[model samples]
Target: ISPQTCTEGFAYDRRARQCIDVDECRTLPDACRGDMRCVNQNGGYLPEIPADPEPPSYPRVRTTAQCILGYTPAEDGTCNDIDECETNSHHCNPTQVCINTAGGYTCSCTEGYWLIGGQCQDIDECRYGYCQQLCANVPGSYSCSCNPGFILNTDSRTCQDVDECADEPCTHACFNTYGSFMCNCDEGFELAADGTSCIDLDECSFSEFLCQHRCVNTPGSFSCVCPLGYYVFEDGRSCEDINECDTGNNTCTTAQVCFNFQGGHTCLDPLQCHSPYIEVSDNQCMCSAENPACRDKPFTILYRHMDLSSGRSVPADIFQMQATTRYPGAFYIFQIKSGNEGREFYMRQTSNVSATLVLSRPIKGPREVVLDLEMVTVNNVINFRGSSIIRLTIFVSEHPF
Candidate 1:
């Protein structure tokens, strides 16, 4: 009767001139249970049941077969677990690993990465502040580093400084510092350009240092060397006078004396008597212009006691005299001022300028006679007289004792 009635569950109503479903369930109160829904059909109603509240038994109302998360419906109309890892149905990141659970899939971060908010993220292990010196953050780990001239210790988190001078790297002196070292030379040495070896300093070349005579350079020090006549002083930098005379290093003769000066020595010749006045044998004379003569003039004579025995006329002592300027026939007058002991001693002229003495005494044990003799030679032409004095000692003993 109306166009709206052609549709299902619609009926024509003449009072309102519209198509509508009959309210059969509402009018019939005992049509369906309380928990069941009522559905209007073509001139009838249908009952819709709800799920059951208890387990291990079918529901009070029938329901369609469905699958939960990570599961799919099988050919037998039963729920089956799905392998999301293999089927690629998981919603995990590409860098993460997907694993199948009982009814869901799980996501895990790979190596060198971590998981955050169901995604794979790079972990910064350096944020832990475990490194002692310098730290480098890798994906999921950390590394320790050190500065130049240093090395890392056994512990990965800490660093240690290196000592480059421990192995005797320097030729002279080795100095150690933080993370490095240096080579130094002594006072008399210079460091080489390579900074390891040392070179000897030329102390002789400098005018301010070293000895005044000579200078010698050694490995790490210098020495002051003196010349032949000088020696090194106590300070080791200056030269001192070497007393060659006192040290017995001189070659002065017996007649000379050695004198030491600043850098050398002198051999001085001592004084001696002149030619005419002969020097005393085996002795030197200190002669000068003022006093040029020797102190004593001595001559010796010998007489045998057997020859001078009693009643013997042979002469025992003979004396010879000469002058620097002498005439052939000049006569010399002689006088004995001493040795006038008795008639036992007799003196007589033997020649023009010579004399002899005879001892006529019988010596008992031993006897010595000292005589002071004087001679005067006169020149008759001008009446000029010259005199000489002499002192002599004679011994008269048996066997010439």
Candidate 2:
């Protein structure tokens, strides 16, 4: 049998993994498994192993920020764009425009509101500003306030005419326009209610009851009146009365007493007695049979005197008017008081020289003493002759008050 040596000196290719034998005589070979050969490859030392080995790592893809170099994430994890306009914290004069980007801000000129020192500010519209009617400022925009009679409806952004008449722009009425209003009064007469509407005046009619007589109508106004029995007084419209009595208004009856005065006449009492005799009561009286005494001889005379206050007593002298010789029975004298309360009054007395007074039962009301003389004998009427001194005594009950 022949013995072969595994360790030998040679060069080998991986793709063409074939081993090219080394010249053993020129190269020095050390112990490689007891006399092995030594070989070299493109990558360096060669060792005998398997083909198509596993690699150490995989390929990686690059991101945008990462691809563009020098870019870094902020603390918020966002990338920022640098602003050149505000780079050094500087604004480019008053005329330059400023703009802001992702991470920075800028400033520029716009309309209305302005920018100062790179900061935005407001503009005063009330100054000689650009609002046609009125002005209002908001941030970077402007609004309008309509002139007096003209108004702007903010919701519609349109101009509405203000009614000057409605607003009473002038004293009474208003006429409104897009930007203003006017006032006026109409026709022959002035305004009726508002300063705008027209009204008429009646100058041809008697306006005031100017006719002093009956307000007669001629033109605008009028007059005075003179009544039948009156003449024009001091005042233009007043009249003075002319008395009808002076105008002969007296139409009196033949028996009527016509007493005439300044304005009229009156019929008075005739003062002539139509009925005769003396009064015995309120509406009655008696007529005497004879007026003259025939002759004065031994004839009897009886006169009774009565006291009005006391209903029970008579004057002492009248108690003995005549004797009981001819006229007998009794005569009753009644004293008259004022009321009809308790008793009827009468008195019985004898016509003797020593006559006694007798009072009757009491009575009331305006009383009268009845001089009742009667004949006890043959019914012969005693003749009362003439006047005599009759002493009358009055008796009265003391009032209880």
Candidate 3:
């Protein structure tokens, strides 16, 4: 090798006897072009290329300096803010807001929202007690609501109670309270299970003693009823026997007497003498001594009248007959002598001097019955037998009670 020729980026070292590489980046300040870095290789120096190989072109105009982004140069040689909001040139999303600063503008989330992880998120206004009853959150906004029985007020944040009674929800009456309502029924009526309807109150079924005789249930009240010879008292709960004789409500003729009892009335003939009998007193008749028919007839006949209810139960003691005068060593026997064709009545001898008239069978009627009850007295010491007859007329009512 005559002179040891080296490459352009290499230098020859005499002592070492070899070409050496040079660090061009450290030795030459302008080793590479603008915006490019320099590197030394084993045989040559290499210039590092940039990502953008070409530089930006600018206008051929004379100016002191260029303004930064989001600003512009003013006529007075000062930087001015580029109002991105007014010019609609901001980088903020459509739902965000843009605010201007000294030399630039900033992007921020709108009202009722906050920036979270570079995205606009709705703020939970309800957590701050923004509404009195209810709240709902939407994108960048919020709303207030009310419960079922309340209404939103004009303030939009407060709640007011709704008057449900204004719609007439109750059948009878309605009462309004805070956030609720109630229903009430009228007199003689009751509230149903549904709480908004009314039903008739069964006053008669509630108490059997509401009426003395019978209870009649009406729409909303009860009435007392009495049988045919009685009337309801002024108190509307008791019954009083009607005196048909005094009230002239009986069907007695001119020759009959009207007799009143507890539930009915009867007509009876005045004391009169039959063919072989003579009237001795107002209620008694005796046999004539000269008449042969009187020999077989009873020694004395007494007239009586009574009233009873229809469908009278059997074995019911209706009347009692006791001998007024007592004779020593004398005993009496009782029998239903006549007018008992159906055998509805019988005589029960309780003692030697007394007898009871019992209903042996049930009798139903708006009718009348005549019974001839006889009592015979036997005196063995006097060796005499005498008999008395009671002509009793019974009037049965049409009702059982």
Q: Which candidate number has the best TM-score? A: 3
lDDT of candidates 1 onward, in order: 0.62, 0.41, 0.80
C-alpha positional error of residue 396 in candidate 2 after TM-score superposition, expressed in Å: 85
Model 1 lDDT at residue 266: 60
TM-score of 1: 0.43
lDDT of 2 by residue, 134-208 (tens): 677676676777766566776534567766566454543456655565456533344556545545434325344
How well does candidate 2 match the true structure in TM-score terms? 0.25
Segments in model 1 whose C-alpha atoms lie over 4 Å from true places:
1-67, 72-80, 111-144, 153-157, 163-166, 172-178, 184-187, 203-209, 271-401
Error of 3 at 273 (Å): 2.0
Selected candidate, larger TM-score, 1 vs 3: 3
Q: For candidate 3, write residues 1-401 as lDDT tens digits.
A: 11246545556787887656656677887877766666554333466665666755532222332344667767654457788788887788766688877657788987888888777788888888889999997666779999888999999989999999999999999999898899999888999999999999889998877887789888778788887678889998887888888989889998987787667776767776876788899888889656778776798889887878778787899999988778999999899999999988888889889999999888887778888899988899999788889988888877665
Top-lDDT structure, candidate number? 3
Pick by TM-score: 1 or 2, better one: 1
Any residue pairs clashing in model 3, and if so which?
A: none
- Model 3 alpha-carbon drift over 4 Å, by segment: 1-72, 84-95, 124-130, 166-171, 191-219, 225-228, 248-256, 262-264, 288-292, 312-315, 341-343
